[model samples]
Target: MSHECTTEDCRNHTSTYLCGRCTSDLQQWLDKVPVLVRELSVTVARLDNVRPAGGGGGGGHQPGSAAPISLDALQLQENLRSVGTDAKAYAQDSRAAGLAWLIQDWVTKAELLVSGPDEPPINHAANRERVRNIAPAMPTRELLPWLRQNARIVVTSMDIRNWARRGKLNPVGREPQPTYHPHEVINAWHDTRVP
Candidate 1:
């Protein structure tokens, strides 16, 4: 069965975790990580260098800073790992080996995101959500029946109209036949249910 691509704003279908196009994009981005790692390694090494003793220092010139960027780099790594990665952030400045390490770490994550784990569980396919439109928006005609059957709740088209008018449910599909994702409708039903 097909699964909808998880990449934001991308609406592609795939048999794997990510669609082919997204996977290719991720691979291209991953290509830059190694070169960056090499550069950061050099920078970190240079930062580790010590000043020669008595090199035109007559008065006060204590060995400036002991690894100035090292603490910052460690903090940056912690922050980077906390939020995960975004395609847009790849172009941002990165001068620390810590950032490089996180970037390199993405390779494994990319593999997991594009495809399942090396040895997926036996019930992986059964647990996966099959594609049926990003969230499967149903217009009023289809929405009513689906809610009755799946949610086991009664809702009139007029009630749907009122909810839309009152900002209760937002339509995912636009225009004359506005459609709402079933989950949204189910949520509204639950909210308005008495006891």
Candidate 2:
């Protein structure tokens, strides 16, 4: 069966993988096209016959000749500008194409690395969420009934003096008493009973 060539400019396939020499030459051409265009533009623009020197005159000569914008020098100026613009655009587009090829190659290599013969299983977000929801919530009030049902008893009291000294508990305004939420106290008791 015939296959498409990897080179974007020439996609004709002759039953081989881009023919090794064409692949190498294509890479070199793509690499040098931009540099060549840039240097050519600079050299063309720098020619003494192109840019006007000293006081501005028609095509760098005394007036009474063709206007500077209409002379051969002006044509060279426009050509240099066109070449530079085209080169920059070509370079950007070629880079994007190269990156896409690299990404495809990496993904294929990664797939091969995962398992030689076996196909990988598909993963779905909904099944992952279902697995996450199986755990039960541990609430303090629920434990109180269990402890009472089991005939377990424990004595506990807040050490207000030590708590206040350590800044662990804040005093009710002007009352010199530290306040504890009912749930927090129950949770602490449940910890001692359970663990």
TM-score of each: 0.30, 0.22
Could you tell me the TM-score of candidate 2?
Answer: 0.22
- The top-ranked prediction according to lDDT is 1
Q: Which stretches of candidate 1 lie over 4 Å from their true place?
A: 1-135
lDDT of 2 by residue, 114-188 (tens): 223476674434433443354222223443343344324332343333444565434333334334433333334
Model 2, stretches more than 4 Å misplaced? 3-18, 48-195
What is the lDDT of every predicted structure here? 0.54, 0.40
lDDT of 1 by residue, 6-28 (tens): 55576787655556676567556
Give candidates' CA RMSD values in order. Answer: 21.2, 23.5
Q: Considering summed lDDT, which 10 consecutive residues are worst modelled in model 1?
A: 124-133
lDDT of 1 at 25: 71
75: Cα error in model 1, Å: 68
